[model samples]
Target: MTRIPHETSGEPNPLRALGLDTLRRRTSMKWRTYPEDVLPLWVAEMDVPLAEPVVRAVTDALALGDTGYPAGTAYAEALADFAGKRWGWAGLAVERTAIVPDVMLGAVEMIKLVTGPGDAVVVNTPVYPPFFEFVTHMDRQVAQAPLGPDLRIDPGTLEESFRRAVADGRRAAFLLCSPHNPTGTVHTAEELSTVARLAERYGVRVVADEIHAPLVLDGADFVPYLSVPGGESGLSLMSASKAWNLAGLKAALAIAGPAAGADLARLPEEVSHGPSHLGVIAHSAALRDGNAWLDALLAGLDDNRSLLSDLLAEYLPGIVHRPGEATYLAWLDCRALGLGDDPAQVFLHRGRVALNSGLPFGTGGAGHVRLNLATAPEVLTEAVRRMAAVLE
Candidate 1:
């Protein structure tokens, strides 16, 4: 495959740097879930090479036979440094953070700290499918606060859900997907502040899944939910897994705001054992030394975003896609195609292109499909072509 370098940075676009044959040879779910004939662009996994720093870190640990239990606050400290330098926020207190297996597991532990069984765990739909499945599996009731027409948070809807969630003074928790999944909408500071205020008013603890924090593309800013004025009691789950293509590494951090230190401290010590030592080493290295590579990946994603829009307009004109400001996921509205609620199935079965069906994402998910944009530009274009062919 021809290597496409980022326009400004001159760094090779990770998405285009790897060839299809190279990708297919891997055993990851994104490539292996479907047969060789189907184009798989359904999951969160990014189709890219590992950052050099991450590779070196893991390789060095193995070379030294340093495979053992994870120890120290290196990951937390590295994240704090990255947060301060990148997001202009220095409030990541290492003492208030705990290592978890991954973002979802961290979220589960954080939710457990704030609510009991059967308590309502609020979410904005259509959201990441796991947000519904995992919360429900934990014995907590899932409450919906669907986003507005613009794919941003609907304060009225959110407030109404909050009111219902905490009815009769019941304990509730909000699982906030910052730089939201599927949609890729980066929540602004003002919007997040409003979320904080409302959560405070309703006595609902806010657990922000900020795994996509580093993927904020051009034209937006990522407001760390705990950095807002009214967010002192919020908890956040962050990781390099999503941003740096380290999902298989299985490492994440659960950060607590100043006021929520006590609650975070209540997290079971065994929870820390879930993350592999190699995973910790790789994640810490990514945070500490992966900026240049991350910048290249972001630029590639930006290019792919524009490319996708153009391709959709030229081919699948009926599909409505409001390009998101963060992450590499594009939530495309397929309702206009008259495909009913699950267009992904039509595309998959007929077009031989796999996509995430909207039905499982809940609420607004129906008539929609989430497309992963972290692959090569050619693959993305081909995926759209196949999708357009389905309508023909």
Candidate 2:
């Protein structure tokens, strides 16, 4: 294991300074998508440097000419160790794990293993847009269940959707987004247990997208769906991509709960062949050796979340901003700002601040925009300054 420097081991701001001059040189879609004047904050990509262990792991692999095919259980075992240490999830059996190209793709494959085309899949709207796209691509019908007024999953609405999806007596599935995207709500243990019970009652299989499990902020507990009671029959898609700023590397793990082992075992061998060999190496090293660096990044994000709240209050006071308990996304209600249903369009054209338009997030998305909060405090301040100028 690589040793972290004493100076940075507990530095409050361990993440490197993310200045605009340094960031604009990158070619990632988030940086290169808009004109030079536009400050891009739409994508989930972080504006931080690579963790030392991840860099060393990738470099060492290249130096030894060890890059070949993805194999072995090192990655799974590493995640198991991390989960046990960080989240207290002791039941993550490595034997039931598999590597996939990415989270959404793994979800498609998992959905296929449990259901066939034309089967309905229940999902919360104002969700990650890919949820809708992937379900359509799988030839599966999506049963939309909008989150209630509080933007948290409502039991009544969920039960209603589950009832509808299984109404024809066909086996349907539920796609759960934990620490939900766009809004960033860390679904509580009780909520997850309720979902499990409902799924069990209706005989529906559950697939949890838990990629953000490690990014729970401010001491908020992130309850992995499979860790709660009644989650034994479900499957989870987890990855180091979001937490470690490795989206470009492309690797994720698919874990099957105890009761779902038989169905997961039937997944085709071809499924494991496509994951990037280097992705596995880097992600494995991240899970095993990047805890110190991750802790530092999380600290920076905690500060940024508060910084965004202050900036919003000072500049765009009309926009309703709620500090999320997890992840670095702020779901801003811009309806009061009179930016119309798609505030992102107005912000892009007038303020040159690129944001994710909320229209595609489904029912609750209108008059809202999802802001990425995993950047430098100054960048967030500048983003709001530009957005406020749109009104001027």
Candidate 3:
């Protein structure tokens, strides 16, 4: 696959950011989930406009009436190339990659292929809600390891869970969330190396959920799992969905490291048949031609992350807010405000603002809410204002 690099300034130019009226017109779940009176900022979807390359690719596909089943290895090749350029990941093996319907589905299938029925799947607590849901959906048991005080994975707790997972001579796998969701904590190379070593010692396979790799904001470096020394036996589920705002596209890739290639090859062929053709096309184009657009989006999101910090400090001074280094989600700690375990309920009922309930995110989620920071600056400003009004 051929790729063209588009140079971009690291800082966001204000002119490129979206405005309030342009965003409110969106008909996505973020907008439609709440009544017009409430300011919605819960869902993972972004309020920004689509990238030009992505839009053009989808439009061309529709014009050609190319809506059919997905084919070929173009998507994999494109991502491999993008990975090399974006994150210094030069070890991407296109032939060892398999396309799937989406990241969660790809992860579940990868878990099934590597481990038997009733195998335990370990996950970090207060993580993405689907990590909890998909493990149960596959009939595998879920093992929880709560994050440390800084919201990063706890090494000691992780080892304990790994030991418990295979205690009875049972098989297990770690569903590692890189640049972790809800909290948006980007894992460092050292942290991932530790996880890889731990997995090796525990006789467990590691499947990294790296769907957020491309969205690592300034000051945080995204290290691909397979690029780590002890990670050659791990598997990775990647997609353009999260970063490119293409979640509804229905396409993702399950990648295997050199040592794990044979295991991935064992994946059921029916799994590869699930991706949509247009989704594959859009993803490929995004990887090949969407870097400049992606850079701009990242710059805007960087501004928003900083913007949220200011907004929180000014309005909701009691709430603990950590500006995320990656992802558009801000995990807010509302414990100091005495909002109970699920503050989202309080915000919606009193402040008329919709935010993701942190309760469903598993352990350590009490007294928290996941605020989507991908909207226009005005929307974020209003969300905090509403939240503060209720407290006042």
Candidate 3 per-residue lDDT, tens place, 1-392, comes to 12233357463543246776776787778778888888888888887667778999999999999998998999999998898887777899998899999999999998998888899999998899999888998899999999999999899999999999999999999999988998888898899999999999999999999999888876578898998989999999999998888988889999999999999999988998889999999999988888877888887788888888898899988999877788888999999998899899999999999999999999989899999888777778888999999988
Q: After superposition, which runs of candidate 1 have C-alpha atoms over 4 Å from their true positions?
A: 1-8
Please give the ranking of all candidate structures by TM-score, highest first, separated by commas: 1, 2, 3
Score every model by TM-score.
0.97, 0.96, 0.95
Report each candidate's C-alpha RMSD, comma-separated, in the order given: 3.7, 3.1, 2.6
User: lDDT of each prediction vs. the true structure?
Assistant: 0.92, 0.89, 0.88
**What's the lDDT for candidate 1?**
0.92
Native-vs-model 2 lDDT?
0.89
Estimate, for each residue in 166-239, the C-alpha lDDT of model 1 and write its tens digit: 88778999999998998999898899999999999999999999999999875467779999988999999999
Candidate 2 vs. true structure, TM-score: 0.96
Query: What lDDT would candidate 3 get against the real structure?
Result: 0.88
- Best lDDT goes to which candidate? 1
Query: In candidate 1, how many Å is residue 45 off?
Result: 0.9
Best by TM-score: 1
